[model samples]
Target: MEILQIDDTLSLKRTVDGGTEEQRKAVKAIISEVRAAGDQALRAFTEKFDAVKLDDFRVTEEEILEAYHAVSSAVVEIITEAAANIRTYHEKQLRPSWMTTAENGTMLGQKVTPLDSVGVYVPGGTAAYPSSVLMNVIPAITAGVERIVMVSPPGQDGKLPPGVLVAADIAGVKEIYKVGGAQAIAALAYGTETIKPVDKITGPGNIFVALAKREVFGDVAIDMIAGPSEIGILADDTARANEIAADLLSQAEHDPRACAVLVTTSRTLAENVLDEVYKQLPHLPRKDIATEAIENFGAIYVADDLEEAVGAINQLAPEHLEIVTENPVGLLGKIKHAGAIFLGRYSSEPVGDYFAGPNHVLPTNGTARFSSPLSVEDFQKKSSIILYSEQAMNENGAKIAEFARLEGLEAHARAVEARLK
Candidate 1:
């Protein structure tokens, strides 16, 4: 890891991969074909990309029962507990429809309604992301969405991962599909023979999945165009060097493009962490991936003061921010931007990733500056409510017409006037 002085020139701005022209063209073709041929296109794409042929894309209840037998009982219990924690957290975010009336007999408020249907895409193949399943599905279920569907690619054996299946079942997702990539996204958005279209699509995947989400965005709601993982640590000499190095590598192992950064007031701590990171790098199973990330995107910055370090972290707006200072909570008010904040050394980033109640589906690539993590609000929408009694309408009808006529909307003015008693 490189150590440098904090300066205005230093930036964590990374260009997001928008995919090559060829890949974008291919995604558009896949979406078009899925819209045109429906289930036939889905089967053909699954065979070509996943190297598996399936007459039925849906996962049967028997298969789900088999998944329970495939995994250990302890794993099932852990997933069930995690699901409970996630549900408890998101249930607090739910809001009921509300309205208010005044002396004028006018009612105005907002009605909150959960989406009719949602599709959650989990990446599959060699690795299974059970956490992704919980993080994306639980919030939607908590929001009371009627139909929740899950899709993932099948392996060469034509079966979804046991852990992924278990997680989905625990998360209260009744529909599971054995398909993935751009085609799955298309099926979710346009509807196939077996899979119905959803109002929104959420979860992360490879570049093709991201591109497909981008292509089908306007037609259906999408969570966000997520990039690789990131972790930013704000620490001082009081923080342990080895622990900091280990936390940084936790995110580094996620992807070659993942970024890990440390900004500290003590120069000695920066140097020590730099050494510790190198020492620990060789022992990781994903050493090749972590090494590439640490070599390219990892950094250690020596700040003149705690204020300067916090300012630098705000500018970066990392997906995950960990403060390991002597008084981490005292510095909370200074943080203006971050997808999630972990105070003190004990609150490791992975705690929020898996066991913690917060959603791990966060805005990446500096989007934390404007966006937020996936929440129940993402699965529900608000509709403005307006009601006017006859007396109220009579009192304001002329003014409303005048205002509308000011904009040369004669029809709007007439509509309001016609309702006036």
Candidate 2:
């Protein structure tokens, strides 16, 4: 990992938020074509991108059942267990329709309504992320979304991954398609003859998919324009350098562009962890990818004090922040922004990525400063319901009329006056 000698305030103004400009332009073109041509364009694009032409894109009930059977019984149990945990965590987030009444008979409330339909995009690139399938689908199901449509690229055999299909089943996803890349995103945004358009789409994909979601955002709601995964480790003299090195390696393995950074007040600890990172990288399965990440984006920053470390972390706004220092709680209040904060050495990024009930789909590339991880709330809508009694209208109508007239909106003023009169 590169050591950034920090002597002044860091200015990271030009960091790429999501993906390259090429990805954005390519995805926008696909979305535009899909919007214009509809299903016919969908089929053509599917054939060209996915390398498989389909008579129908939507999965049948039989397909879901078959998918459940296709996977090992052991794998099925794992997916099922993960689903239960995810459900338990999100159940608390369910928002109920509420009403409030005034003494003068003015009542106002919001109706928490589940969306009619939603879409999920699963990546099928270098690896299949079944966890993402669960993370995206369960929340929509918990929100009582009526229909959940999913799309992922098929393998060389032109069939969806068994793990993805099984996870979808566990999460109560009803419709899935054998299409992926930007084209799949387009098909979901603008309905194809076979792939129906959905109200919203969730889940993570490659840069192309992220860009496609950004392009079709107004047409269909998306979880977030997610970027590469990242982690920030705040360690002190109390922490073990080996353990800290292991934690940084966990995030480095995600992608070459992924960031695995270490910020420490002790120069000795920082140097030890750097030495340990080299020792541990070779044994890892994705060492090649991790090595690239560590070589480029990965950093070991030596801070003058703990406060300086926190200040740098807040500025980075990493997807996962690990406070591995002494008295992690004491420093907790110092962290102003992050996608998810892992306190103490035991609380690693992997714990949250798997097993833990928290949603792993997080904001990336410093977007956490403004965005949040995916949750049940992302799938639901809120509608305000208001009822004013005649007496209440009489009490406030003159003031309302005057306020509207002050804005030079005579029609608005007359509308209230007519009701009061």
Candidate 3:
């Protein structure tokens, strides 16, 4: 990993944004064909990409029932604990429909209703992640989504990983499917003969899966255009180099494109953390992927001051940000754009990733500057609430009529005028 010395600002927005365009175009093309072709396209793509010849895509209720006993008690206990934490966190994020009545007789309120159905795409085959099942399903359940459907590519043996099935069931998913990749996204976007279309889709997958989600976003509501996981640490001389290095390796192991970065004011600290990262990498099972990710995108920045370190961190806008400084709470206010903020040495990134109540599915790349982590709010929609009495309408109708005429939307103004009259 190259150490970028921050004496001046360099625009990183162009670099990150420019990288996804090609993948986006290819994904958009796949979605269009799949939406138009429907069932046949899904079948063809399943064979083409997943190398599986599946005549049926829906997982049976029988399979879900059997999934319970397929896993050992130890795994079930872990999933149970994670689900409870996730459900607890998301329940707090729930906001019911609200109203404030005026002195006038007009009744008004916003109805907060969950989507009737939603799709959760769990990556299967070799890319299975049980944690993602918990992250995606718990919030949708909390938001009151009536039917939650899951899709994942099946193995040659025609079964999902027992852990993935166990996690989804624990998180309250009502259905599962044997489809994956862009076609699975397309199947969720446009219903096939077997798989029903969903109102929204949430989960993480490969670049193809990500691109497909982007293509079908408007047709079917999507959580975010997810990229590889990323983490940025803002530390000082007071921070522990070994712990900081471990945190960096954590994200790097997620994917080959994942990024782990450190920005610090102390030059010696930067060097020490880099050494620790090398030592830690050898102990991880996913060392090859983490090594590729860290060697390519991982970096350490030595800043002249804390302000400069923060300025660069903001430019990155990482999915996970940890302040491992002496007074992490003091530095809390300084961070403006991170999917989630972890403070103190013990409050590492993995706390939020697993047992902590917060959602692990978060905005990636620099999207944290504008987007947010997934929550119950993502599963629900809000409609604007407006109320006006006859008196209020009568007083304001003429002005609204005049303004509507300026925009050539007189019919809109006339509706109010007619109400007033």
Candidate 4:
């Protein structure tokens, strides 16, 4: 990793929007074909991308039972515990409909309703994501969404990963599909002969999958256009260099473009972390991927003071921020932007990713400046409720009619004046 002085400004947006023209064209064509041909297009694209032909895209009851038995009992137990934690955290986010009445007999309130159905996309093959299933589906379950659909590609051997199947079952997701990529996104947006359309889709995938979600957005809701994973650490001399290096590498191994950054006031600590990163890089199983990521996107910034370090973090608006300093709790109030925050050295980034009950699906590419993390709010809708009694209307109708007439609309004034008499 390269070290830089904080005097120089950094450009945080890494890649071009929607990828290259070729990728955009390819994704556009896939979405169109899937929209036109439906099931036939799904099967053709599944065979083309996944290299396996399938007679049926839906997972059967027997296959799910086999998946449960195939996975070790220990794995099942761990997933169950994680699911319970997620459920407990989301249940606190549940909202109820409320109304308030005034002396004027006017009632106003909001009605919170859950979506009818939702689709979750999970990357298949070597990217086994049982934790993602738990994070995406549990919030919808807590929001009271009726149907939860999951889609993933089968392995070359033509079987979904047993752990993924078992996790889906644990999360209460009943409908699992054997298709993936942009085509799968299209099927979920516009219902095919076999698969019913969903109200929303949530989860992460490759560039094609992200672009497909973008294209089908107005037709159905999506979580976010998630970019590569990133982590930003703000540490002082009191922080451990080895622990910082280990946490940074956790996100770098996810992709060659993933970013890992550290900003500190101590130059000596920066040097130590740089040395520790190089020492530990070779030991990782995904060392090649992490190496490319670190070489391209990783950095260490040495700031003159802790205030300057906090300013830099605010400018970057990282997806995940870790504060490891002498007074982490004091610094927490200064942080203005970040999808998630982990304070102190004991609270590592992975604690929230896997076990801490917070949703790991977060805003990326500086989107934390405005957007938010995946939650039960994403799976529900709110409708405004309003009621006006005759006495209330009589009091406000003439004023409304005068305002409408001032706007040069006779019909608008008449609508309010009709009830006046």
Candidate 5:
């Protein structure tokens, strides 16, 4: 890993966001073709990109039952436990419709409604992570969304992974489609003969999938456009070098462009962690990907003090932050921006990624400064409620009409005046 002194302008912006002009154009074309051609477009694109020709797109009930049998009972138990933890955590975030009425008889409230339908994209390309299926679908289920549709690319064998299908069943996802890429996103947004349009879409994907989400966002709500995975460790001499190295490698192994950084007050510690990273790299199965991420996007910066490290972290706004210092909780107050923060040595990033109950679908590319992690709220919508008694309207309508007239809205003013009389 490269080492640098913490400067005012740290190079956290070294990586680019997903999709280029050419890629964007291609994604738009796929979306357009899918919108126009419907199921036929999905079939053609599935064969072209996934290298599998399918007579149908929906995963059968028999396939789901077979998927359960395919995986070990041990795996099912693990997923079940994780799902319970996830459900418990998100249940705390549930909100109810609320209203307030004043003595003057003005009633104001918000009605929180779950979306009617949703589409969740699960990537089955180079890797298949059942954790994502759980993270994306559970919140919608908890929100009481009526219909949940899931789409994933089929392998060359024209089959979905058993773990993925099993996890979907655990999450209560009923409609599973064997289509993927930009075309799948289009099918979800605009509706094909086989796939119905959804109110929203959520999940992580590659550049093509990310671009497709961007293009269809206005037509249908979507989760944030995720970038490459990243982890930032803010530590001191109290933290273990080897443990820090292991945590960094977890994210680095995700993609060639993934970033892993260490910010510390001890130069000795920085050097030790750097050496430890090299030591641990060779042992990982995804060593080649980790090495590329470490060589290109990874770095270790020595800060003058913890304050400087905290400031740099806020600037970077990392998707995952691990605070391993003498007092992780104390440092928490200073962190202004981050998608999810893992405290202490034991609370590693993967804990939150899999079993920790919090949503792992996080905003990336420094968007955490303004955005938040996926939560039960993402699956629900809120509408403001207003009702006034005749007495209340008699007192307020003239004022409302005057305000509307100041904005040069004559129709709005007249409507309020009519109500007043």
Candidate 6:
């Protein structure tokens, strides 16, 4: 890990990958084929990419039961508890349809409606993240989406991971599919013979999956184009070096492009954390990935004071921000940007990743400056409602016509005039 002085030139912004031209072309072809051939295209692509030939793509209830048997009872209980916490958190975000009326006999408000259907893509390749299934699916369920579909790649044995299946079941997902990559995204965006199209797609995947989401965005809604994991820590001399090092590596192990940074007021703490990170790196199972990430993107900065440290971290706008200062809660109001804020030593970043009630799906690559984490609002749409009594229409009809005619919209003016007469 490199240590440096905080300056204006320092930035944590990473370039968002848009995929190579060849990859884009391939994604376009896959989407077109899925739209044209439907289920046949899905089967062919599953065979070619996943090396699993399946006449049916959907997971059966029997398979789900088998998945339960494969997983330990303790793990099942944990997932069930996590699902309950997530549901309880998201249910607070649900808002009711509201309207207001005045003496003029006019009613205006917004009606909130959950999406008809949603597709959640859980990545399958090097590892299976059951946490993602809970993070992405629970909010949609909370919003009362009628249909929720899950798609993940099957292993060489032609079965999805047991943990992933268990999490989906606990999260109230009834539909699961054994397909992945660009093709699964296509199937979600455009209906296949067996899988109906969804109104929105959410979750993270490889570069190809990101590209497919980008291509299909306008046709159907999508979550943001997420980048690799990131963690930014604001600490002081009171913070422990070893604990901070471990929290940084937790995100570093996720991807080679993952970033971990520390901005602190203590030079002694900075040097100790740098040494501690190197000492701990060799022992991790994902040492190769974490080492690459740490060598390339990890850094420790010594700021003049706590105010300077907070300012630097706000500029980074990290996906996860941990405040390990003596008074972490006092600094909360000063934090202008962060996907999730963990205060004090006990509230580590991983708490939010798994057991914590907050959604782990967050904006990365400095996008937290403008966007937000995945929430129930993402799975719901708002419709504006307008109502006018006859008296109100008579009072404002001429003014409405004049305003329309001012914009040279004669047809619009005539429509209101006809209603008035």
TM-scores vs. true structure, each candidate? 0.98, 0.93, 0.92, 0.97, 0.98, 0.98
- Please identify model 1 stretches exceeding 4 Å from their true place: none
Model 3's lDDT to the true fold? 0.85
Better of 2 and 6 by lDDT: 6
Best by lDDT: 6
On lDDT, the stronger of 3 and 6 is 6
Per-residue C-alpha lDDT of model 5 across residues 208-245, encoded as one tens digit per residue: 99899988999999988899998999999999999999
Lowest lDDT 10-residue stretch of candidate 1: 6-15
For candidate 6, write residues 1-421 as lDDT tens digits: 7999999877774577888999999999999999999999999999999888999889999999999999999999999999999999999999999999979989999999999999999999879999999999999999999999999999999999999999999999999999999999999999998999999999999999999999999999999899999999999999999999999999999999899999999999999999999999999999999999999889999999999999999999999999999999999999998999999999999999998899999999998999899999999999999998888889999999999999999999999999895
RMSD of each: 1.2, 2.2, 2.4, 1.3, 1.1, 1.2
Q: TM-score of predicted model 5?
A: 0.98
User: How well does model 6 score by local distance difference test?
Assistant: 0.95
lDDT of 3 by residue, 1-421 (tens): 7667974553222234323777777677778877788778878887887787878777777787688788889889988998898898889898989888766656688989898999998887546688889998889989989999999988877778888888887887778888888888988988877778999999888778877887787888998878878899999999989999999999999878888989999999999998999999989999999999889888899989888888888888889999988788887788898999999899999999988889888988788999999999999998868877787677778998989999999798888778776
* Cα distance off (Å), candidate 2, residue 37: 4.4
Native RMSD of candidate 4 (Å): 1.3
Which residue runs of candidate 3 sit more than 4 Å off their true CA positions? 9-33, 106-108, 419-421
Please report how far candidate 5 places residue 309 from its true position, in Å.
1.0
Model 4 agreement with the true structure over 1-421: per-residue lDDT tens digits: 7899876566453763577789989999999998899999999999999999998999988888999999889999999999999899989989899999989989999999999999999997547999999999999999999999999988886778988999999999999999999999999999898889999999999989999999899999999999989999999999999999999999999988898999999999999999999999999999999999999989999999999999999988999999999999999999999999999989999999988898999998998999999999999999999999888999999999999999999999999999996
Candidate 6: which stretches are off by over 4 Å?
A: none
- Which pairs clash in the backbone of model 2? none
How accurate locally, in lDDT, is each candidate? 0.94, 0.84, 0.85, 0.92, 0.92, 0.95
Residue 244's lDDT in candidate 1: 96
Model 4 residue 79 CA deviation in Å: 0.7
